[model samples]
Target: MTSNTILQNATETTISGDAQVINAGRDVNMVHGPPAGLSQLLRPVSNATYTRSGPVAKCDPGTRVEVINMIRNWLNRRDKQSVCWLNGPAGYGKSALSQTIAERYANKGRLLGSFFFLRGAGDRSHIARLIPTLAHQISISVPVTKRLIGRALEEDCTMLDSSASIVHQFQRLIANPLSSPLNLFSFFAKSKILVIDGLDECDDKVQMAEFIEMLIDMSQRDQLPCRIFLTSRVEEHIRKKFGDARAQSVLYCIDLAAFDARPDIQLYFEQEFGHIYDQNLPIMRRIPQPWPSSQALSVLLDKAGSSFMFAATLVRLVGEDSMPSKVLQEVLDSGSNGLDPLYKQVLSSASPTPAFHRVIGTIMILLTNQSIESLSLLLDIQAGEIVFELLKVQSIVKIPGDDNKPIMLYHTSLRDFLTTKS
Candidate 1:
């Protein structure tokens, strides 16, 4: 049973003297359980854009080594600049870099918590659960944190209530426990990292601003033990909010776009292109190893426009199509126009079947994910048929481990490509 279910039934058992007989294990868990409101706020890790402990197969390698080094420099120093923003556009490798850092510190025991705020991935989209989730994680990770956090919640259980302000929740749920003398593990020799990625994805402008303010307040004080590392697009809301003296005092900013992506981008094309050649050689013998000629690769690099998404999108398209040269030629001729035509080419090349067209269109416009069975049911088609259609575009759409998991987009640009009227 869920912690909430067990607690609810336990409450009823006291009044009615009978509910379903409670399990001992569940009862024990409930004693340490967060309030029902906080429990409901838990977004499954699968909802995060990057699920694994590290970067996945198609993800470009770690070219942001300097960015990671900069973060370390900040962490090692006694400076009060607790918050660092790795700001960049949609297609830059900010999320990937964030994932790498979280995994690195977490394994070393210096990671207090990691929260990835994905766009359109349910509760993962907002700051509602941010503090509570961090609280629960840190409390469990560092044993002494339990007394500090547990006492706070026990004293004021309404802290997690919907009416509670964001600052209030952070002050109690995050700031209180962190500021205390945490029980030390041998691995925790340094300040821990609290990684919050994709801040721009959270739609609540007001709550977001309040959360930043709270971070600024904590940075000035000796309380909170961990340094905050956040990644987001430089949205105007964040720009205006962080413009304050307090925000500026504690904030360290890094622009991912400022770095050279060419070397990394080149490595990405060479590797993925080689993978496609090896995998699809039997289907089409014409494509050669190191498939795109050196000249053509140069052409691609010039037009990639310093965006990893540009490279990623084209690679996905090439993976799906047997004729990589045709796609390469199209890309070469498209000139400096950017990703518009390449997207159009992919969409226009959709299967002639109406079902396939419908599936692609729906996936493009649908902000969030749905299961294969759910999509089939929603589209009034068989599950097998939906899978078949999705397989045709395996490069762009990511199928989950099972039918129960939602189908996710490989990149958000596909949505922009399909939804816009170009």
Candidate 2:
């Protein structure tokens, strides 16, 4: 199908919240899901829903359309050899954009599968979890392979057998099914895109680099029809790997920072506030107020420093507790250092006692980027005790999941602000 037609049909299908079913040819029919397993798999373990709610800010619709068009083109192209790298700093909405595109294609009966790598979530860090998650996402039965993989595990397994170094295993598992003539094109036809987000956040940078190389190899060989769309911070290791010869001609790299941000940021915040006001406080609804008042938004825009997380956090913090007037005053007075006001608000809400502060300070100093268990040892405190204390103030401290390892700040800005203070 043409890209435009695919987009239109996809949008229409989504309006009714039903999957588009297509009969390719003969008696062979491909039905997209009313209850797609892939959609359920993409959801974060904590939150099953796909939509993000926040204040509405201006988003460059033109840019968004361009991105969507590019991805749609890649998926529609018969060559099936391209890989798209969408790189951006934390909180730049790269994942959100990709997710939206995946959903649109899935609705249109174009997408085969997708995976979201959530940082600090247990499944995100380990290769064992990552591979199985992706396999499940594609609705490929994995019982036999899962049993083989499980049996390979040993308490004293060498590096080759360890769960952490499962790159070869993943490549084999994904590639073997498509190696056969009968299943090659059929398998590829079923999966139009392989969406992977937050490559930099994966704990083992080395393994992530290997996985990217393997993907590059697979794309070059044209062994599968799937195009990989990866979103990450442009970390050094990833840049080097993508710079390799295999990626030179086939890869399309788009930097998130290069895009104009003013519109999208404005749209995001505006939408968020509008939703809350309309749905929660119908009586208080009025003509949409121009948020950030140009002057205030300019300050927020400047202070955000190209980080959407910073901007969103500030908006949420100020809007939740204070009036518009107060929020504006706080932003203006704080000037370029608006982060402090947000941080302070979070801190105050945390209500950290002298002991809590000491514990936090110690963790901040001794294990600036280490996991929670490491912090527990440095503090000479039980891991559970530390976790309980941190969870009480999670909004400020950024506690990781129970199944996950350590907790940290939602952003580096929080860690920087906390550690630098006397």
Candidate 3:
């Protein structure tokens, strides 16, 4: 399916109000109720879902069509080449494409679950929540697997303990349940898949290694019966893991950077500039209809460098408290490395202090993630004071939507600048 079709009709699955189906069973070993804290351990992490076209944003029209079709075709096919990976560097829109495809299949009732990883966002950024989250969703969607999964959890509550191996948890809590008599024969025959994006952003290197190895073994051996659509940067660790010569035959791969990004990016510039002209008619009353000059468009496109995040950051810079013409002029004057100047603009506008520096440093360098409250404890400050400092640089740092959410860098480049641009 085209990306346009996916965006218009797709909806993500949520567990907020899903009714728990509890039934008594024949086997004495199988317990009915989940163990006291097992459900929490298995609970899906918050803010893991990415909306296709809501507040979070979606792919612009005419973007990622080819990639979308390629993935859909693979998902529809039934074969032992069971894993399709869309790999690329940061800012190339891998996560956006993943969300669009997820919405498409989810609207068609084929998506088992999707996990989006944000670096330094705690559980959302690790393999810790991967198995339980997938198991919970599949049980809810497939229903029959629920009883089997409950029994597995009841048998040994330590299945999800930190000390237990990733392979062990996945085998008992996830693979075994789905492959049980409940749904084995039909699984390989079906056209469904699980969507996992941002694998490289996951923090635990050892766990990630075991996670990928176990997944490869299961698919090749037919131990588990679902297809996986995964996206990540070709980080050295991930690249090495997938490079195992024996598994190469079963892994399908795509590198997004090699494709021509000019056409889609050009269209995005046109639409956004037109919106700016309409929205600020009073300030832009005399601006031309296709507001930006061709010369300016050429310059901006040159700096976009085929990276979607670069294009997006430039658009925001133009629209924010500055005239389009003046911003475009500044952009044209900047050298090939235009993002550096733009980064400086954002930092100067924020007017940082020592405390703000400390808060932002923690946000950028965190090993996993922590919410504002937890950060306060770690930083030895009042909880309310954290957001107060974060507000100064809200443009670059995303304050969470709730009390439970962690602060995050809006783009990977922001982290890049903070850590290396001394």
Question: Model 1: how far is 293 from its true place, Å?
Answer: 2.0
Order of candidates by lDDT, top first?
A: 3, 1, 2
Please tell me which model should have the higher lDDT, number 2 or number 3.
Answer: 3
lDDT of each: 0.71, 0.58, 0.73
Positional deviation of residue 313's Cα in model 3 after best superposition, in angstroms: 2.0
- Tell me the alpha-carbon RMSD of every candidate: 5.8, 14.7, 10.9
Please list the residue runs of candidate 2 whose C-alpha ends up more than 4 Å from where it truly belongs after superposition.
1-63, 109-111, 140-167, 184-191, 274-291, 322-324, 337-345, 348-351, 355-422
lDDT of model 2 at residue 306? 58
lDDT winner between 1 and 3, please give it.
Answer: 3
Backbone clash pairs for candidate 3 read none
Q: What is the lDDT, from 0 to 100, of the residue 293 in candidate 2?
A: 60
Candidate achieving higher lDDT, 1 or 2: 1
- The TM-score measured for candidate 1 stands at 0.82
lDDT of 1 at 177: 67
Stretch of 10 with least lDDT, candidate 1 = 13-22
TM-score of each: 0.82, 0.65, 0.83
